[model samples]
Target: MKKVLLVFCLIAISTLGYSQISGGIKGGVNFANVDADGDPDGKTGYHVGAFLTVGAAGIFIQPELLYSFKGAEDFDLTYIEVPILLKKNFAKVLNVHLGPQFGFLTKAEADFGGGSQDIKDELKGMDLSAVVGAGLNLPGGLSAGLRYVLGLSDIADNDALPETKNRTFQIYVGYKLFGN
Candidate 1:
């Protein structure tokens, strides 16, 4: 019984230490929207980030640091967002990811009667979001993926304008630092 227990511990330790680490840069564009109360319109934005991957077999975890721009076009509202997700590969060239995101209202620009001007505080300051996506590995160590960012927290404080939330779709291109 003692010998069996020792062998079991050794196997477990070996498996835990056999993971590989990889790092790379990723960037993408977002089709964003600020859902107020009624119709939802699309806006243009983008994100840039760095990622670290640790994995064994077909499963992996990827942690990313990103700077993202999000907004609505008709209303002309924008925010800076950061998202982190854990990813798992189910096939040799396919994977899925889901995680949480937080955003800060940075600069807001709008068109007044005379001309466009920068506005100070039109909405809430911070927002919380949920992210989910799928990825495909391409040729030459490159990968492409698409993600959806859905606002889970309200960003509006005014009752007249209605509570608003953010929704976005992002397409990403990335390079694998290390993985099989």
Candidate 2:
């Protein structure tokens, strides 16, 4: 994990030169849920973040830092997630993104006033996922997109409970402040 993160960082930093750099903020709605033994229901949440887009032409690099809310009806989780995506531009108005994401769990608790509990131990410290999305690349960097995040790691600590993973569908709008 460390090596992968380091390599990604190096690549992102190296690509900043001789490329277009655009920074922007985005906010979106999350249709999130967990696939686990309990069959917990899906939940609606929100995520807001900022991103730096590097590169130009047919290929681009977009690295984002987002505050994400996720999980199922029984529990809610908050995470600080970083997604580093490689994008390919098609024509002038279409773009597709594929990437890996790293997430750190910041908050976890039962919902519906189930009361507070130290449930961090029951969850994974770090979450890993793969993201795939498509966007409409409009002029002036204004854009709207949809993404699907598939969790690659199991979060449940107990062996009795079925393996749990995250499944999220996100809709967001973005605008570029500068650069292409």
Task: Tell me each candidate's TM-score.
Answer: 0.78, 0.86
Query: What is the overall TM-score of model 2 with all chains considered together?
Result: 0.86
Clashes by residue pair, model 2:
none
lDDT of 2 by residue, 1-180 (tens): 999999999987876665777798898999999988768889999999999887767788899999999989878889999999999889979999999999999988874576766677778888999999999988777989999999999987767657989889999999887766
In model 2, which runs have C-alpha deviations exceeding 4 angstroms?
1-18
Q: In candidate 1, how many Å is residue 140 off?
A: 2.9
Model 1 over residues 32-69: C-alpha lDDT tens digits? 88777666667788888778777788677777777777
- Give me the displacement of residue 43 in model 2, in angstroms: 0.3
Backbone clashes under 3 angstroms, per model: 0, 0
Q: Cα lDDT of model 2 overall?
A: 0.88
- lDDT, residue 14, candidate 2: 74
Worst 10 residues of 1 by lDDT: 73-82
Q: Among all windows of ten consecutive residues in candidate 2, which has the lowest summed lDDT?
A: 111-120
